[model samples]
Target: MSFGDLLHQAGGMGRFQFIHVTLLAVPILMMASHNLLQNFTAATPEHHCQIHDRDNDTRRLNVTEQPGPTTELLRAFLPLDATQRPANCLRFTAAQWRFLNPNATGANATRADVEPCLDGWSYDRSEFASTIITQWDLVCDFRRFQQMAQSIYMAGVLLGGVVFGGLSDKYGRRAPLIWSYMQMAVAGSCAAFSPNFISYCIFRFLTGMALSGIILNGVCLTVEWIPTNVRTIIGTMNGYCYSVGQLILVGVAYAIRDWRWLQLAVSLPFFIFFLYSWWFAESARWQILTGKPGDAVQELRRVARINGKKEEVDKLTLEMLKCTMQREMASVKSTYSVIDLVRTPTIRRITCCISLVWFSTSFSYYGLAMDLQNFGVNIYLIQVIFGAVDIPAKFISVLVMSYFGRRVTQAGSLILGGLAILANIFVPLELQTLRTSMAVLGKGCLSASFNCTFLYTGELYPTVISKVSDDEQKEKILLQTTDIEKTKPTG
Candidate 1:
């Protein structure tokens, strides 16, 4: 009998499968939190150069005791940019008290000599009580550091996919996934308590690496254990969990305005995930293919017992597992590598197309998702809208794909998303509602594109090349680095 028959004999999709899938899917909810954590954790608040101590005293007094005259007093100490807001990087060399006169126009204020913020900056803390930006003073000249931190984190993610993908194939999914849980918990917590920007980035990099490992191995474990008929449904459900997580981040970030506390809140749950992860059985298919039929038999029997098929599984043995998976093991003996992806013309073309799709989808997806502050709305409200759109978008995508097919679904979503993004360029900036709507539309379509890409890419690759190709596919996440510079907000 084939392995599928063996799985049926062991009570496929029974109680054990339910629990296994539930536990595995729970961790996925937080994956979105980590992926989009920077949106809240690094939010730049309104800031301006610090005024001299004497002028600062006057400003403070004006804020607390006398309000009207302090408006003009601020003009004496700070220069207004084109937007007529205080310039973020410059301060008057000495207070131009003349500008405090009510008749002094903005033109007269512009003539005052200014210098770089030599002392420091003062941030408006109405929205965020704390963030990496405020904590580290990553404003003006240091603003690029914010994007640099995210790039480093994405680099770690790229490396983790390469490292853990092969390691899971060699070692086993459960082990790497278990280790990844602990790593995420530890690294993310460490990032929360990081004493400096460099340390925070380092910890976040490790957290990103662990995130990749968790995702890669978690999917492998879930797919390998479950019956094939239900795989698509289960996969879609897991994707939904990530969408739910985006909404969860909005609530948590709103409640805890401090970045460190927010980071800790999202991270500590992984520790619970790590603790229970030890209960998971390794993939029986992996065990059999790797020449451990004895262990595979044991695991299958354990699953059978849990699924209430003890009588049927009592007859199971190592010989039966080896006999059933003999062909699969034989196939495993032949190795594949990156070179094989392009060794043939057809495969080469497929690889290139899949890579491009992955790159573009991720590029546009993160570019919009990461720049929530630029949307010119309440960040919490915009985040909620962004998260909410994904639910409908993914649901529609699944229906379209089921009815129309993968190619049509994938291509249509990308085209629609691109048109949405392009349409924004011609719209007037003053039309805030229209701009926000268009952005949300583009983001949702891109999210749908991402959903289609995953299933489509998996179907396109042959089994022999699939594993290697999946790893290579993840490597293309390096394309995310290019977006760091592209998405930076302009003055």
Candidate 2:
């Protein structure tokens, strides 16, 4: 490219701005689309128990009268031949609510004192855990099958992380991104139409496996694209974009109550992402060091152009080509190993503590969010509440990380979330207003911590965890447990 041409590329601002926004927006979009998985199983379909009679009769179960809570609870412990069924909540006495769980080792747990079972044919998200396991098929297989599906997906992510992360670094970010997105879109759509349990599990597994490639590297690609000055803000903001993904699930699920439609809704848009490379460049940092300085220079010229710098573009681009190649090559040659992450006393301590923090935070955050449906509120209302909190929590995160470093802010958020979860377990049902209030606070900070961890992990691992690092084993471990989300749903 000529000097003036370079200058023109940089000087002209109109189209370049759009390109920058478009390129950076993918990760945000990827993160945004993540909500479909996170919230799907938490959502349940409208169902009710069909009371039946003893064998030798083909008559459908009668619902001539609306049964009260007691009848509902004792309906489980009765003889089908009984002449009459009691409809009062008082009929079940204090014995049965505890029996729903049937394994609670606690004494004195009864309908009045225990959590109530939901009846009727509407969504009941609070029972997501129970519903998926025991409430499904009225035989407890619902929750069990739900657990298996999620577990398989998590397992796929583990494998994908190994396969994809290496491929991302080895082949450069663009190719795997192209391949995986296409696969995910197809697999996700197919999963919706799966006719059997095995088919659903297989397709969903492929969907997540495909996703691990894009979402994991998308963040790295963004980091490499932008300068360090505002990386935190950019990454966190991108993380908050996950709210958009969740919101998408909200709209889709609300509109299409069937799981099959929801599955189709979640997985169909990534085809455009498969074509993203036609308009975008690979990570310039990765390219320059990978002995593709000329290509990297071309990409940088585009970025500089987008940034609207008109002066000495070709000269600066050439200089980068010469100097950046060697520096980047040297850095790549020294690619990190896990040993470097913990070789020093300080490094190891930081690594251990932070790893613990990441694990604990992930475990608690998902555990709580999945349990939100069990709180006896409207599932839609609960979702709206949780989602609404995420926005403010994101806002606070931008401010908090600005005031304090990532470490401090993350620690504080995790601590608060941990305490809140503990507090919620003991909060009385009568004081449910306060219980919900605590839930809001806990979930918000938990959401914030979840966001904060991504930013923190990216910063903490630096050369070690970034594609820059060569500690394949360490990365494998990290990715193996990466999602750390609901392995199995609990109602």
Candidate 3:
């Protein structure tokens, strides 16, 4: 019998596989947290140019706290926009400040040319105490740095997918998987104490690198162990875990207003996961393919014991395993590379089509995710809703993909998502409620598209190139698209 056939006879889709897949889901949850952590950690709060109160009189009169004489004085001289809100990045000069008085009766204040903030920017600490924007002053002319920091992190993910993908294919899945978890833990922890933006980006990049391994290896490990028939269910369940984690992040960020503490909070979980990494089982099939029949047999026996099938597994001798490994190895070739994916006409067409789907899905999904506040609602509440909507969408995608097939579910959802995105363009800005609803609906459809695309891609690719070639290409496309989006001015 083939290894898969043997595995089916041993005990496919049993308690052993279920528990193993569940353990693997922890990293998936953390991946979601790590991926979207930037939305809060780099968020820019309401801010205004710091007025230099030389006399130290206005320092205590924060307008957000309470209005006072000092507050009125600063408001009179500070440049106001068309909406009458204080200009965040510009202020009146000291010479102009002297002529303006809060208590003067009918005194005409001469308009002065606005200058860039000299002292610093004052942040509204009501929602957040410190973010990358507040910590490094990535506001005003420096605002691009915040988005660049995010792109830098995504670049790390791109590179990680390339490097770790090869390493996992070369080495067994377990070692690379453990190494990625540790790297993420160490790098993410260090990121919390980053003294400057440069160091933070460096650590975040490393964390992103490690994240690719977790994703690539974790999914591979779970899928390899489980029966092929149940791969879709498991994959969808993983997506659900990711979306649930996104919802939980809303509370985590809301409670921990400081960016450093939030970073620390998110990173610390990886340490626990790293320690639990010891229990992770190596892929028996990988061992058999790599010429380690002895280890493969031992792992299979262990799995059988865990699933309470020792009686049937014991009847299978060492010779049976050796023969099965030889047959598997004889049929398998080690001469594959990413170039071969496009070497054939059929594969090239498949690659191009899937790549486009991945690019568009990622662009719309993440763009909508990051633009949650643009829905004209509370940012935190909107983010929570966005995440909440994804849970049902993920489960539904699995059902639809299973019943309606991959292409139909994938194409239909993508079309719906695109339409939902265009819906926002025509909605009147004054109708905030309607616009927000459209955005939420669009996010839900895009979430479904995201889930379906991944499932479809998995079903489309041959097992040999799934983690290596396809994942790398998809992540690179996502990073490239997101980087371009970040360069555009925020609406």
Which prediction has the highest lDDT against the true structure? 1
CA lDDT of each prediction against the hidden true structure: 0.83, 0.57, 0.75
* Residue pairs clashing, model 3: none
Alpha-carbon lDDT of model 3: 0.75
Q: List residue ranges in candidate 3 displaced over 4 A.
A: 54-72, 95-110, 325-327, 464-491
What is the full ranking by lDDT, best candidate first? 1, 3, 2
lDDT of 1 by residue, 288-328 (tens): 76778888888899999999997978678877777776766
Give the Cα RMSD of candidate 2: 9.1
Which of the two candidates, 2 or 3, achieves a greater TM-score against the reference? Answer: 3
Kindly indicate the candidate among 1 and 2 with the higher lDDT.
1
* Top-TM-score structure, candidate number: 1
Reference-based lDDT, residue 449, model 2: 83
The C-alpha RMSD of each candidate to the native structure, in angstroms, is 6.5, 9.1, 6.9
Better of 1 and 3 by TM-score: 1
TM for every model, in the order presented, reads 0.92, 0.73, 0.88
User: At residue 157, what lDDT does model 3 achieve?
Assistant: 86
Candidate 1 vs candidate 2: which has greater TM-score? 1
Residue 194 local lDDT, model 1? 97
